[model samples]
Target: MNQRALFAAAAATVLSSALLNMAPAAAQDMGKDMGKEKCYGIAKAGQNDCANLSGSHSCAGQAKTDMSKDEWKYVAKGTCKQMSGLTADEAKMSMTKKM
Candidate 1:
């Protein structure tokens, strides 16, 4: 292979190796949520943890407004109320009342 082609292949291998190493750490971070609970009405714009209570979006980080009742984030268990956030059911009910 030419020097340029060899350099490109080496760079690709290094980048892929680095990304593979990161996968385990990312999964470990997700595992930290085992004891967490969903806290609604606390996620800032584009910071939601997963699908929202509303059917508008089906993915995380799609919230358009801060403290939206439909958006949620994972907080330590039993702290949702302390954080001025609501439970899933409460958020759903609140959304219902606004309609």
Candidate 2:
């Protein structure tokens, strides 16, 4: 192959190899949260981890209010209550009582 073509192929191979090497580390970092627990009422506005309890939105970062009792974020397991957050059931009950 010409020098330019050879250089381009080498760069692509290096980039692909670097990305492949990063994939496992990225996956491992994600797995670190596997033991986390959902802590409701802790997420600030637009900072939730996933869907809200009320089903108003089906995606994360959609909370319109802070500590809404419906929004949640992942906290270390058993640390939810310590952070003054509620479980899904408790948040559901709280919302129910408010309505």
Which candidate leads the pack in lDDT? 1
Model 1 lDDT-worst window of ten: 23-32
lDDT of each: 0.83, 0.81
Q: lDDT tens string, model 1, 41-94?
A: 999999887778787875666899999999988888888999999988999999
Q: Which candidate is the best by TM-score?
A: 1
lDDT per residue (tens digit) for residues 1-99 in model 2: 899999999999999888766653454355256887778899999988767878897566689999989998888888999999998899999999998
How high a TM-score does candidate 1 get?
A: 0.67
Error of 1 at 14 (Å): 23
* Candidate 2 lDDT trough over 10 residues, lowest sum: 23-32
Scored by lDDT, model 1 comes in at: 0.83
Clashes of each: 0, 0
Residue pairs with clashing backbones, model 2: none
